[model samples]
Target: MSEPSRIAALVVAAGRGARAGAGDPKQYRLVGGESVLGRVLALLGAHEAIDRILVVTHPDDGDFYARTTTALAPAAREKLLAPVQGAATRQGSVAAGLARLADGAAPEIVLVHDAARPFLTPDLVSRAIAAAQAHGAAIPGISVVDTIKRVDETGRVVETPPRATLRAVQTPQAFRFAPLAEAHRTAVAAGRDDFTDDGALMEWAGHPVVVFAGEAGNVKLTHPQDFAATGGPETRMITRLATGFDVHAFTVGDHVWLGGVRIPHTRGVLAHSDGDVVLHALTDALLGALAEGDIGTHFPPSDPQWKSASSDRFLAFAAERVRARGGIIDLLDATILAEAPKVGPHREAMREAIARAADIPVSRVSIKATTTEKLGFTGRGEGIAAQAAATIRLPEEDA
Candidate 1:
């Protein structure tokens, strides 16, 4: 059995927020210590099930956003796929985000959220994702709490609309990838660009849109008063953790490639290729992201195509895949275990090797080594093992 790939979170921050009357956009205005968009992105980015993230913003404002929000760090800023000058409407920004996620393949599920709404909880995100997975289109909507009325142009009440059937929707709407994409396409073809949210477009497409309960606290920062009324817990931040492991049996080779650098060894690890356990582990870590199969699924040992192949190539391929999917690798920590070949002497060189392979800075790549006191195959001096953990920075939102 195989694990399903993760859903992608797409945050739309390109809105002008004309009604807010703030000096900056509503999403960029300071709320607590962070901007509204920062809080929203951080909340979504912290979710373990989310894979890629893409934030759609005005082209000119992208750099400004980096300076204002920690949610998109420098590395994450480099991965942004924002199209300059988003559409005049929110749907236009969504279209741009969908295009970015569709670069390689669209995500299985796309969670569309508003940067103006920063109080969304992890539970809300999880609920939206669950409903989307089950119902194809799921939107968070709260039953109308206020009295309702229908008026004509003459300012006379024509009818009192039923509040029971009315619901106010929120952002972080989740949808099955294909259906949502098609809904946008269909809307655009019909020249209907008035939709304020993706869920509305789905509903117009005649797709069944399941509505789940929503929180009033999950309010969008539209007016100055709304901006001052913040909700939810504080200091919700996003962090990424990665783990990697590799093993190699003893071989008669004279040298081994550890972390992309060829290190001198009396007995090299036996494998189909250069037997670079360090790079193999790093590759696996990258693949582990989004649950995208392992290195074996990509480059099979039984295949003649990978014979004597340099493991660094595998690492580069993984990095490229991440980039092609609108993501960037941020930092990595790798550990090697072996009885004989000392890793301490080559730690600096290994760092350089991995940095080059991952196309990141040497400062972001850390390599260390430790022995198991002659315990397992590696401790018995029969083979070498390497493990790695990679921290990747993806776009703040994705389709």
Candidate 2:
């Protein structure tokens, strides 16, 4: 039997994204705690149908790409081909990626995607691939909800198109590899690189294109405000809050771990994990928000896998569970009640470490310290106590 046809994904991420304003190109910027490109790559890598993945980047962005991809899972990293340098225009950049794919064993079907669209789900990918396999060329599109007007040079509305017949196109456009490659080469030979998208180029080459249903949630990040508008923690419609508390008694050690940071102290806490009181409290706060059980329930002391495990791992797992449920960690506030190894000295470091572990920004994490007036166990320096509150936002489902 002939080998099964292979499918590949080509991500075009060379644009400077000047309209997004300031900092790295929008693709490298963080959205929901992960870079836009990294999220796209992770989604594509997690899809079972996509055989290989290629990225096209700007020449000066190699270092930025490396740094941004550091958060990707090992399996995702394994699927990526070394990124190739792109040209000035988006069309040229896509063509460059196509050439690289052709240099090796070319895939039978190619899915062209935009790095800016970080929310591309696996179902959308499968739909596009299936459409392309059946129709030879396919693109995803959503019905236009608003009326569209065609205007002339004088800013006059020439005609109002029927909104029912209109559709807003999106990327991850799929096509048969051989014809798409030939179409790109023909366009380049004829100096016709101004076509807006690959589907248009294919149309100009007399190829038929089909449209599949596009996901409304798969929005592309363009302007700076777009980041805040797309269900980000700052603007989510549904909000939840939960509180947690933890205490670890002092032992005969020289240091203590709090919020993933190590502090020099005269004594330490006895526990199965690293005994980070702050992180433990924060993890439970997150789990509480999700209506899930506490850290002990997820990682029982009886389980050898959790023996001496770092508390940061527990917090990271909780954060991921929130994301998996289509939620964002909006805010995290913690207060440490301790009399020794002053938390003031490492406040910023603790916030940073917690933010890193939770995959959120430091601005969203708050750390504070208090002394209990030497009236209790914490005041006597016998142990450290931490209290935390977590705010999370999840999509509301209809009852």
Candidate 3:
């Protein structure tokens, strides 16, 4: 069998991103839970078509790059190459990345990408590669939705162009590696480094460039407000609230567990798992928010794996479940109903514990304690009960 074509991705991330506000850099800013550039890197590195991935960054951005890269999976990490320092302009940054690739056995096709554009999907990458294989130079572009006009330096309307011929281009722009390298060399030799993207450089070299259909939702994060946008209907942010309640009867034990905290008590609760009513209620609340069923549905008492398992793991699992679906936990509030055990002293500790379990800020967790005024099972000191409410945000998708 003939050797398969090797593909690479060069991510340009050298710009100061001064328009994105005063922050670590636009690419390093957090969107959802992951950084912008980190999202692109993970996506490209995990892609089956991309054999290697290189990043170009400003010299001062080394620390930020190192911190953001730590979140990649082992496979993505393995495909990542040492980043190269870039020049002042975006074109120079891409050229620096290309130079690094030239030092090694160059790939057959290369997809030059912007690290600030974090929403490129694997299917889009596949399309870019296919286009590159069929055509020497290709770039993905969306049809222009707004009207186009040409204006002179004097602010006079020069001409109105037909909107049908206009397109808003996006990356990763695909090209044959050797031709692109030659084009960059020619541009450098001619002192013509003003080309914004590789596609334009190819055009200047007299190479025909084709446009492929690009995703409408694949937007680049430019300003601070762009990071707040969920892109489109499929990823629109929606808020949700759910409530959960659990009751556990007192059993024979030295201490009782509530919200992942151990406290001296006359009796322990009775149930499967750790019997922490607070955690159980919080887990159920999170599941309820996702409409994914209660804790019992996920971890049945019928299963032996959950025998005496810590309730922290259960809460953590629910939190991960939210993040896995591109959601975030806004708040988790739990109230303990118990006459004895006095949950006051351990309230702060409980908040900290819940915060750790959910991987959220400590301030976002709230733990309260009260009694039933000596009326119900909790009032009789026979059992402990907890009611929890969770607030979360998730992408709204059509059924």
Candidate 4:
């Protein structure tokens, strides 16, 4: 048997999508509390068949793209190749992505997808990949159920095509890499840039294309009404609660960081990061809810890069993982155990700082402080301890 065929996915997200209206482009817009592109990337990155993933983005959207990656798991983000700048047209953008893929050892198969569609499922991905391997090219399409119509510019009825013969196409359009690349190059050389989708370009190039069943739920966000219809940022969610605890011994510095807020203290906590015990415990709590891993798993103290790193990044990353899984941080409650530098004066500030780091409202965050009745290390003023509990809401299906 020969070596397994390498597969990759190209996500086209460079379009401005002005028709979708206002704010950021449609792909960057939030749907169910996660950016559309984030959801798309999550599904594709989780797919077993895909070996590598590439995203084509607009030149001006670099910052947006960077912000979007925060929503991905550390492992999923590793699969992504550096984003390539897209051109004025969709075809041009795809060509740019293809060029990036070609720069490395090209994969045997490639899936061209639209970042606007976030409901792609594992079954759909498997079918597309299998079909592409069997046939030179394949696309996912849904059979049309409504009456078909053909009209001229004058609004005169020209012809009514049979609905049974019509199918609405969807993306994760799969093709053998070589032929697709050749087709794109041929189209560019011929100055035929009118084709809207890669499958159409392949057809124009005389390549046989097959159609697989498409998923109805794999709808693309196209209009403002579409966002509203999908329930916008707030969707029905399943709630989960997780708890974390951490302890750090008092060391040399004169200040202590708690919940991302600095409190002037007689001694600091011994830690690799800024020693924000509250934020560290809260981050672990959020990560525990997702079952992704602990704080040490993501940011090992052994790594010099994370030494003295701000604990807020860990909290932000955990929160983004929740969003990537189509979840939200419902509430976070943390208690700091210490005997110095009273927390009462800085309670509201700590709450606000944690809220900012988790990208949640201050009202959803609660920070409290208490003594151990002179019983443990914390009560002896030798160390500080933090305990956190987080309630997260995720899609029930993901539960």
Which portions of model 1 miss their true places by more than 4 Å?
1-5, 68-85, 231-399
Q: Compared to the true structure, candidate 2 yields what TM-score?
A: 0.64
**Candidate 2: what lDDT?**
0.88
What global local distance difference test value does model 1 have? 0.78
Among residues 3 or more apart in sequence or in different chains, the pairs in candidate 4 whose N, CA or C atoms overlap within 3 Å are none
Model 2, which residues run further than 4 Å from truth?
1-5, 231-291, 294-320, 325-399
Per-residue lDDT, model 2, residue 124, is 97
- Arranged by TM-score with the best first, the candidates are 4, 2, 3, 1
> Model 4 TM-score?
0.66
| lDDT (10s digit) by residue, model 1, range 195-280 | 98888899899998999988888888887677645522232323345677888888787888888888787877779988898899
Quote model 1's TM-score: 0.57
Please give the lDDT score for candidate 3.
0.86
Give the better candidate number (3 or 4) by TM-score. Answer: 4
Error of 3 at 24 (Å): 1.7
How much is the lDDT of residue 288 in candidate 2? Answer: 96
As for TM-score, the candidate ahead, 2 or 4, is 4
**How would you encode candidate 2's per-residue C-alpha lDDT over 1-399 as one tens digit per residue?**
545439999999999999988788889887665678988997887688887899999988888899766556545666788998888888899999999988868889999999999999999999999999999999999998888999999999999999988889999999999999999999999999898788889999999999899999888899989987864434424689999999989999999998899999888899888999999999999999999999989999999988889999999999999988877788999999988889988999999899878877577899998999998888887889999999987766400
| Best-first order by lDDT | 4, 2, 3, 1
- lDDT (10s digit) by residue, model 3, range 202-291: 999999999999999899888767876744222456789999999988999888888889888878778788899999999999999999
lDDT of 4: 0.88
> Which RMSD values do the candidates have, in order?
11.8, 9.1, 9.6, 10.3
Per-residue lDDT, model 4, residue 47, is: 79
